[model samples]
Target: MNYLLIENDKCVGVCDYEPNVGNDNIQVITYSGNIPQERLIYVDGKVADMNNYTFINGKYVKKTKAIENLLNTNDEAKHYLNDTDWLVIRHRDQLALGQTTSLTNEQYLDLLTKRQAARERVVEYGE
Candidate 1:
């Protein structure tokens, strides 16, 4: 059986066996033949399901991580901008030299448009 080492009503960590008695705050809850994942709440001597739940006022409540998702989207947008920045620079360099770019004008314009949109998303969604 795996042991969940709880401290101050929170599952601080897991242990393979009951630890040597010392700290009173470190309570041990036994899991019968199962290993629970992190962020699972132990309430009323039972483990809650693996979901976006938070312990509030001695109970678990479902929560949505919208800001986290928005931040992730912003990060993805920033990455896209970084990945395609060279293409925009190359287009400008070729334009200044009056040389034919590898990409057509339409393609270059599309790239610019997409890059602008990515920047907008980063500004709107990022921290």
Candidate 2:
């Protein structure tokens, strides 16, 4: 999900890079559409600017982000905030409704047994 990000002509930075083993600095990497190494800029521990990146119009931009911030969002700010307790059912029959998720081992087994029973039907014979 690496995107070529640019700030302007003054400075350019490629966030897409590999970390150097010893230094905190990111190794300026060259990939398809990557800026020339000499043209890239970095200051302190971060890429100070990102305006010189080469990109085309209408290209969807993306970036590789640290995983730390992924789970930091609250339920409301999150995209799909499902209730931890309620089961989501598409229909209303025994088989129509699905079990609430997060089942334990025993619960899962019980669900399987119930599912088997729900799928069965009584048969009658007439004289």
- Per-residue lDDT for 2-31 in model 2, tens only? 333333322334445442335423244334
Candidate 2 residue spans exceeding 4 A from truth:
1-101, 122-127
Model 2 lDDT-worst window of ten? 83-92
Q: Best candidate, TM-score-wise?
A: 1
Give the CA lDDT, 0 to 100, for residue 6 in model 2: 33
- lDDT string, candidate 1, 2-92, tens digits: 7777765567777788776485767778887555556655666776654656444455555568645665778899999999989989989
What is candidate 1's TM-score against the reference? 0.47
The lDDT leader among the candidates is: 1
C-alpha TM-score for every candidate: 0.47, 0.18
lDDT of 2: 0.36
Candidate 2 residue-wise lDDT at 24: 27
